[model samples]
Target: MASPRALPTPISATSFFQSKPTAHSLNSSSVSKNLSFWRNGSGLLQLITLGSTRSRSNAVENSSPTQFSSESSQISDVPILSCSEATEKLRTTRETYESKQQYLAMYSSIFGGITTDPAAMVIPMDDHMVHRGHGVFDTAAIMDGYLYELDQHLDRFLGSAAMAKIKLPFDRETMRRILIQTVSASKCRKGSLRYWLSAGPGDFQLSPSGCHKASLYAIVIQDLSPSDNKGIKVITSSVQIKPPQFAVMKSVNYLPNALSKMEAEENDSYAAIWLDEDGYIAEGPNMNVAFVTKEKELLMPRFDKILSGCTAKRVLVLAEGLVKEGKLRGTRVGDLTVEEGKKADEMMLIGSGVLVRPVVQWDDQIIGDGKEGPVTQSLLNLILEDMKSGPATVRVPVPY
Candidate 1:
């Protein structure tokens, strides 16, 4: 190997770093030579030179073995590209090599832009929602070119945004039209539609006052795994539920809910259900809990301290027919005890993603003869029927 100059000494904040890493100036010849050296295998050379500039989180990976040992003159081997040169290099490389996996249409209100190009679904780093959890979001299912309960979900989405103190970028009707337009642009028939109301991008600060305005974004997702109506098991969650004010807001602050779900999966259950501080059955991480009493009454926990679930509310409404038919004597909401829930004739979880799911077991105890009970399945069929051929009051057809 050819010999090279000694490496530049490490620069501390008070030392040559106060100026630049290359405090030692080079002649035109040396600069040309350095630039040439950086053209190939220069990633390693810049590692030491730019170490102080990059924070610890900028983790770079180099799977291939290094060509030279530490004894090599890294400073001499590294090239120093001018601003223009670096920009051109990066732009060319990014154009040729950097690409994202394909996605359906996405709409962003920041620039009032909607595009199918996955590359265009970008957000600024300074968004308060990105840094300070100052945003709210909601999703509605798309089936056979119909938007399922979009109005209800949007109502909740707006409600959450209000609770988060994030104002809508547009009026309610305009927002609804935009949502439908976004979904229609995606041209997806069987998938999901997820959208967000963000405290718009601005200075990275604790308060969102600096934000220009709130923004809305929407995207389409393909949910191939339709609800199978299979029975699943759940356990009482140990994670603490959020206070009523924050809990009802469906904001992006979901760490606790996520942990609760993980806790259930870790324990070999389908989902985790939380309990109030007083030990009343609260709700699941992302769903609601309901039960068919031995006396044939359908009961659910009050929405006072939880996110008022859209799907749960719809189930309650749809279950009214069962009430008139004498299948369910009545349907109502109240504080439910865990002990009462474990002894119910049937239990089911309700959510938009899962229309209705039978709960056969809770912890180690069997729920109602250890089988998916009749009422649970009946309600599941009802929800499914509403989805496929429900009245226009519940389904919104996509223009595409």
Candidate 2:
């Protein structure tokens, strides 16, 4: 009646399915009991055993064979895979799937090198960033072999890390060099670069004091999708927005943002906009929201209670051109009520990902004439132009 130990050797899937005597062979009476359990509820029991192997799991080691029912035996049939077998399985699983974006290169401070293989791009499970969400991240767009606003995004990334109380693994200059080198290695002309700063690997605890050292991780993603300029609809989110302190930092915690986005999709909209605790328009789930009032003044919600988006800041600079040209009266950032936003002549979402996407509808209200406004179209064109041939300060060249 003793519990069986984990298998030392890995077994093939074919041999696993074939009837053979296991290390701890069950007696005829035990087999009869198992067969009876299968007859009673075979489908669910088989599903429970489908991918199980006799692994060295703590629960399996602590289990008492004498106390187990037939169902427990079904769960115990998992094979204990060797390291090589596990690696092979991971490779096979990766190969079986297709993704829209291709990961071109990755740099991990833990391993102290870069890897181009997607299968090898993995982080430690014990990293505080992975388990405890003690991490901060930022992104910069890659266009024509140049990184757009790399310094700006890195500045924000470091600020977030400071707010999270995470120590820097390297100086800002060194981290910037590594990111540029990673993008250069990728040989991707047009894509995006995302990186993270974490509290590093440590024991699974709520606090990060046990972490060994801080960590830096970066990846270059190859994105080839054509830009879409079509207007989209958005709905007001019911999800609670994060507090001002956490909201200002670019942390890895995005549960509410994701839920709000899903809620928008359920309502057949593009994105969800969040209202602050004071019933004023805050921002979108992952982007900044902006409106053009009837007086042609560009207005955006203040960043005091929301993320200060890099793209949104640049848009403010670009909006100055419209004002000089008399296309816009002025630009302002302050609290915007839902009624004010809905009554605006034009609305748009701005972020590194979206880049000046016009909003045609907000809830049941049609923005302006429920069409992409001329000013919105012009702003998108201006951003596109800036990305292609912006000033040296905004564009950092990658020596690929």
Candidate 3:
């Protein structure tokens, strides 16, 4: 059976799914070359000659159908989708939003001015941060009209930006004010605020030297549902944790962290835990882990190679009341190994997203008494109280 010659080349999703096709061409000499191929039994039998692959690619874009001779292969009379025809086949409908109601509100500052316009909530495509990942970000949780630890996370955010060498668009005081105001603008009493500092829009260059200044973005994310403290399982993350320098700074480079979490999910676990090179426990992808020892001591990993978790530190402080009440002997920070961590009386993951989560198991082994220990619940209640009515130092009041 003779293979169909000049059978239309099958297009990839990129070109085939486009809204329209702009041009068409067929390579004749390349099809007349030495290599024979079948376009999946269209009765087309043609050989790609000795021309270079690059030449074939170029010729496919340059030659016309009349160039291919009928003596070897027959061109299909099936008409291909032209610009106007493809418009009817491949166009997709897009949804429209008049305004972001209670869900989200974004503020962008290109020349250092913030706006709540839905049409303008975007960064320049050429920003160094967009092109080269030269940016840093931090988030704060909002609860019951209060911004929890806004200053603490902001301090860390500024510290991370400094580490990334990205300058601040406004002074520290101004930045804080802008954050509170953005939350107020959204009128979201209970939600989260995420902000980013980026090396502002510029040419597609590797260095920030060509950029004029840095940019700050703030957005209000409404998550009205309360926290879910349900216990979750975890696995040992095989992904290598970033080195101390980059790990300490909360930059946008989260590929390793994302992979680690994905690995845990793939294994039917909540999130994966990374081990330091020395084989001691480090931290989770986004949260910190703490263990209550058989002796009633709270042991947390040192902040040497992981991001210092604000919620974890505060939990430690609140747990000191537990120490005075004799519920715990004391709290300490040091390197923790897997064996030491898994054999504790109780284990909990603490972070902004999950205030405190009791861990029932690690890998295939049960943790502590295989239940949510009393101490974990006690500390959780204490933290919740603090969030609601703690001293003014911890909770920043939202104007809205």
- The models' CA-based lDDT, in order, is 0.78, 0.86, 0.79
Candidate 1 error regions (>4 Å): 1-102
Candidate 2 regions with alpha-carbon error over 4 angstroms:
1-73
> Which of candidates 1 and 2 is the stronger one according to lDDT?
2
lDDT string, candidate 2, 278-309, tens digits: 99999999999999999999999999999999
Query: TM-score of each candidate?
Result: 0.77, 0.84, 0.78
> What TM-score does prediction 2 earn?
0.84
Error of 1 at 183 (Å): 1.0
Best by lDDT: 2
Give the Å error, residue 341, model 2.
0.6
lDDT of 3 by residue, 228-319 (tens): 77677999998999999988899988889999999999999998998887888998999999999999999999998899999999999999
Q: What is the lDDT of residue 360 in candidate 1?
A: 95
Candidate with maximal TM-score: 2
Model 1 local distance difference test score: 0.78
* Backbone clashes under 3 angstroms, per model: 0, 5, 11
